[model samples]
Target: MNSLLPVPPRRHWSTWALLAGLLLLVITSFATLPLKWGDFFSADAVRTTADFLHGFAPPELSPNFLLKVGTATFETLAMSAIGTIIAAVFGALLALPASGRFGKAARQATRGVLNVLRSIPELVWASILLIAAGLGPFAGTLALALHTVGVLGRLFADAFENCPPLPAASLRINGAGPAATFLYATLPQCSPQMLSYTLYRWENNIRAAAILGVVGAGGLGQMLKYHLSLFQMQPAATVIIAMLLMVAAVDGLSYVLRRAMTR
Candidate 1:
């Protein structure tokens, strides 16, 4: 049979050539403009290496430091948990209207607002809250909440968007309003997925809370900063180890929650 369509032209090499030129520019900038590699690899590097090796080999066995770490870790967990909960609750509110399962006009409006809110990062929120609330876990919690609102809102919208249409249709056919259908039909179906996603966000927030202390938010990160400032490698190593263990535990919990949601 005769072909109805014309053959497409061969692709040009100019795009590939341009990409190669950009790659070369990037390599040259890094290799030349950044720093003198030889000097950077000298005595300063040796001192850094020495500091690294001394870490956790003997480890900090200080009872005071251990007490401090324990208290800070609890605060960090509370911050992350509260942050995840705030994110889920606010995100659900925003996601409900933004998902377009309701009226189109309301959906468009809600989505536009959510887009605006979610564009900002959690760290930035923490910075701003620090200014307003002063330095502490309270500020960190607020920061976590604001960022969680954005991240969880997007996930909430996705979960809502992917929900089966049958339930929604059944509710609509019965002349049920948006609020009623959502509470009865939509929430029941989407809750499991939403819970799983929230739990995962909690895991991430734990790490974030640790870092927020660098900005005076109060957590193990602040303790880390103190050890780092004093060049106290052993204590720093202990703090780092504890942080890693906590994050690992959160990861295990996330896996369990995800499986539960699936079941």
Candidate 2:
């Protein structure tokens, strides 16, 4: 009875199950990898990479190239902004049903739609839209909006669902209609979180828009692709730098806005 003993901590069954699943998935993924280790670090690969780097030694700094880059930068910005705005509107509309405000059947249907929309990558959507809309930023904007609506809709719905129901319930108890309760109580509680997600999506869309351009959706990506195709690495380097700057600027703006919202 006086002997010292160590006690084992308790663990939930689900926790063990999750760990098993993760281990299995990792094992499967490793097995599936098509690695050719012998060729990976070969001398030819190293020399080819060095040759490419040599071509990028000096980026084109001429006034004409800078002006072209500046114009494409604005176009990219416009496409992302417009796309995010449209997605926010559509996402908000779908979020209500997705959050179960309209009963189970409607909720399931709306959620299914959102899942489908988000499951298809934006690049795929852009390629499909490109055929219908032709080569331009318009197709890219549509692609961004579609995929973002699905993402923001799911996010907004989750934010709404996670909010404490007390305030909305109180409003309802006082004879407030569903719409009024949502407007005066639920929306106010969730708007900041929704806005934060929207801003984050906008940042991602900026990068997506650039890539979409390579598919003929029209932006700095198109210019970069053109130069790279011709082996004009100097101008391609300039375009790459411009892309980095644009991404950094959007990231900074998103950070400031998110901080302001939290404050």
lDDT of 1: 0.85
Off by over 4 Å in 2: 1-9, 12-14
User: Could you give the C-alpha RMSD of every candidate to the true structure, in order shown?
Assistant: 4.7, 2.7
Judged by lDDT, which candidate is best?
2
- Cα lDDT of model 1 by residue, 1-263, tens digit: 35867778876799789999999999998888857768767999889878778664777878998998888889888989988888788999888777876689988887777776667666788888888899889989888888778778878888888889799889989999888888898889999988988888888899999999888898888888888889888888888888998999989988987997798
Score each candidate by Cα lDDT. 0.85, 0.94
Given candidate 2, what's the lDDT at residue 198? 94
In the predicted model 1, the residue pairs found to clash are none
- Residue-level lDDT of model 2, residues 182-218, one tens digit each, is 9999999999999999999999999998998889888
In model 2, state the lDDT of residue 14. Answer: 95
What stretches of model 1 exceed 4 Å from their correct place?
Answer: 1-51, 101-105
> CA shift at 214, candidate 2, in angstroms?
1.2
Q: Total clashing residue pairs per candidate? A: 0, 0
Clashing pairs in 2: none
